[model samples]
Target chain A: MPLFFDLLGVFFFAVSGSLLAARRGFDIVGSFLLAGMTGFGGGIVRDLILGVVPTAFVNPFYFIPPAIATLLVYFVAPGVQRLVRPLLIFDAAGLALFCTSGTIKALEAGMNPFSATLLGVTSAVGGGLIRDVIANKTPSIFDPHDIYAVPAMMGSGLIAMLWMLGIRGWTWELGVTAVVFALRILSLKLDWRVPKAVGPWHHDTQLR
Target chain B: MPLFFDLLGVFFFAVSGSLLAARRGFDIVGSFLLAGMTGFGGGIVRDLILGVVPTAFVNPFYFIPPAIATLLVYFVAPGVQRLVRPLLIFDAAGLALFCTSGTIKALEAGMNPFSATLLGVTSAVGGGLIRDVIANKTPSIFDPHDIYAVPAMMGSGLIAMLWMLGIRGWTWELGVTAVVFALRILSLKLDWRVPKAVGPWHHDTQLR
Candidate 1:
């Protein structure tokens, strides 16, 4: 069941990545590569940090699904755009699932809870960060409009807390996942944002 | 003197990256970002892997050099192309220096010789890898024509062996750097290639 969710999450993230690449007018090869990275890049970083070879590199299936998703997007982009809302929902679900799974993996690897939470947040948001960097845009995490990282942190933290309470099962995981998704959706709908303070020290000075 | 060399390296790499981005018809912002990544991306990755915050984020000088280099390239791309060879020579020097520095850092972090060597090689070539990925090209390391990683490994291995022999100071370091630069230049001049067996697996099946 977990594997099934993982594959689904991979597919949606690949779709989102391919769409972004297409917006940049990338060729088919670029689209496929970007999609693959979006789906697995964060996990690869996490694994490398843990001193383990990336799971995406070890499992051929992880590669194949993203490739297929990219191809599908290439052939069906016109139709896919019409289903943007549905795809966004799927992406949100995938984000929640990946965050939960990442936290669990870090914990199982004997990392401290704080480190595991950080890993989980990174795993959930790392792909989008790469995509934004490649596309030459300010990452969404840095943008005031998006409540991206907070939800992932909440979800991962909830999982860690629940696991510590001896409630280690799908029910607990799913509940945490649902909470993250709900918070993200609600934030989007309510336009929740971190308060901006325009103090004397904070000016529009370009550092680079 | 070391800081001067490092800045010189940043300038040439930024020029190379910006020129590549211009050739691809990227906008000015894209060119700048590419140049910045090419200049400092490897060091950032090396730091992150060693469980340290990236120095690039903390140092304004690191950001400034790449920004200036990118702006120069943006305004003078046609003239810059004529200096590609010199820029590459500087880049080679940078690669050697970074490889030695990375190995030392890994050793300081108490990593084993193998891990240090691996970190060294990655640090030397990592920026280029990220550059190629963003530019939508297969990484030059994976290219049959490129002898990129081998020189880095040779330089890193030499440094590690010297360190093991209780040799410290600029003498051994400079010697290893010269060897790496010479080997890279020789490989380019002689078109040195690792031999590949002509077999069924080597055949190109796809008709591009």
Candidate 2:
């Protein structure tokens, strides 16, 4: 059941990636590659950091989601072009699951609580970061207008704190996921934003 | 001796990364962070894929070069503003060393030759890719105006082929490094470039 949810998360992430590629006017190869990378890049990086083989590399089934996502996006893009809200909802769900799972895995691997939380946030946001980077755009996490990573950080930090306090179980994990999902969706709907750089600092003070 | 060379490569890569950060008008924190990421990002990613702890994470000494690079760029930007040529030279040197070392490390870890070659190229270009992405720019490897990854590919492929043919030694490794370095330098000097999408293809035919 967990693996099924994980695959669903992968599918959702891949769909977002392919949609971005289509918007960027990339070809089919680009759509497929981006979908795959966006689906698996976070887990691959997380696994690598944990000194384990990436599940995507080991399981053939992991490849199916991205392929399906690419095809779906390519074929139905014209009709599904304005499904931004649905996409954001799916992305939020993926983020919730990934942050929880990543934190749990890192904690199980005996990473320090702080590091585990960091890794958790990475797992949640890393795929979108990779996708935006590949598409040559500012990552939403870095964009002050978006509160994307904050919810993941909050959820991961909460998980780490709970683990430290000896509270660990599926119920706790599920609760954390729900909290993160709600936070993300609410932030998006309410147009919540984080503040950018403050004080008297010129943007072009360094290079020019 | 190899460790020393590796550190030198890291330093060169960090300098290039810091230079880019400065050019992008990032503040001190951005400079340091970008420098650190570019310095060790490749080796860290390679180590992760090879299922080993990243040297950057384990070794405190590995952090020195990026710190120095950030300090150097931050302090000297006014006087050394037009060091693009020197920066490219340093970047090329780093590229040469990283590609060869990455391939050798993969082979030593018992990865197959093709995978080894891919890892090699990734090591050579990963840092720059990360840096560019963070700065919200197109990765140079994907830019048709630059032939950046070609030399790394050539070097990594040659190294893989040689290893498969049972030809392995420091001398061969050094020879391959020289070949890749020269290729990169010459390509830059001659303004050589890879061709963009050639066939009849519209750039903005998909999304809008």
Candidate 3:
């Protein structure tokens, strides 16, 4: 069922979060927090925008994967580095599932198409942003060499397009997810990058 | 009157965010984004956890002050460093207002006191966290020299306690706010810091 796929996506993202935490040298609290944020942060952001209690708090099922991931990272992180290939693949899959579903949810909540697409991208990438920020690094999306956000935007845009075309179904969702997954995986393997912006100003940055 | 105070808080927070952005060398977009985040991010986080559309989007009033603050930062940032003394005052006032109101909102939404207090603290500090994260710095609250989160926590805890005592009024709220504001300002002036944990592990570095 869809719930199963959702949980699977959460599981992979949690592993990625925890693994990243281990690599960064954060203690156990940091690992657990990162896993939760990676698995649920995007959805929580989306839900908050839409005026809903985050599902992560409402359903205990969402906690399981992240908890397991933290334990895995603590126990076997050294060996996990060799599994980068699998990790990247799972990350892509999670991106696909999350981006598509995130767009759908936003649209269903009556958001405008453009904002919905942006929110979808947020739902896909926001968790990683939180993780990177907490680790005191520049967000990967803002990195000139990073291709992470582009494919997520592309997939989210496609979902918005599908909705505009008056077509909505699991079949369409599955097809879009596959395309996003492929694109992400391909981009990773080929070391593709978004054309960098040469902003005319220094990076020193902001306000309320 | 409360709305006026709310806008005043937003304005001050926006200025703080913009000042920080300028110090970090972020461009105009970063200034605007940080302003918005610092002014509205905490409340949005609180609303999301409480299941409400953020008031910022519901009413145009919330957006005005941050926009103005961004403009001010763009126009007169160089001279504003001299304003740091006053800036801390406004920042403390904003923190007091936000912490008290955030706690009240959570209690009204029926969350348990512990969670409500945590949420209130979050609403008080979340914006600065966003700003620091984007600027690629460790959040000040996590720093041993920081007194920010602790004071917010204390204020939030007091609000929760007042609810438990069946004493909820504007008078009580103002008293709590005054106490928190004084504590923050005093800590800043005195260079007070939270004692840090001597953790058993080294800080290695990555999760992915």
Candidate that scores best on DockQ: 2
TM-score of 1: 0.55
lDDT per residue for candidate 1 within A62-94, as digits (tens), equals: 756677866766555444334445445655766
What DockQ, between 0 and 1, does each candidate earn?
0.04, 0.15, 0.13
lDDT of 2 by residue, B1-208 (tens): 6677778889989988877766664545456556767888899888887878776655546768887887777655543347566668878888999999999999999999999999999999988888777877677677665579999999999999999999998889889999999999898778788655654476546634
Best by TM-score: 2
Model 2 chain A poorest ten-residue lDDT run: A195-204
Q: Give the TM-score of chain A, superposed on the true chain A, for all candidates in the order listed.
A: 0.87, 0.88, 0.86
lDDT string for model 1 (B152-189, tens) is 98888888788888887877777887888888778777
Residue pairs in candidate 2 whose N, alpha carbon or C atoms collide under 3 angstroms: none
Per-residue C-alpha lDDT of model 2 across residues A12-90, encoded as one tens digit per residue: 8898888888778898889989988888988987888888888898889998999999899867766655856656776
Model 3 C-alpha lDDT per residue in residues B1-208, reported as the tens digit of each score: 5577567767777877877777777888788888888888788777778877888888888879888988987886567557556545666777877888888888888877876776787778777667667666666445444466667879999999999899988889889988998998888888876422212222242224
Q: Residue pairs in steric clash, candidate 1?
A: none
What's the lDDT for candidate 2?
A: 0.80
lDDT of each: 0.71, 0.80, 0.75
Please give the C-alpha DockQ score of model 1: 0.04
Docking class of 1: incorrect
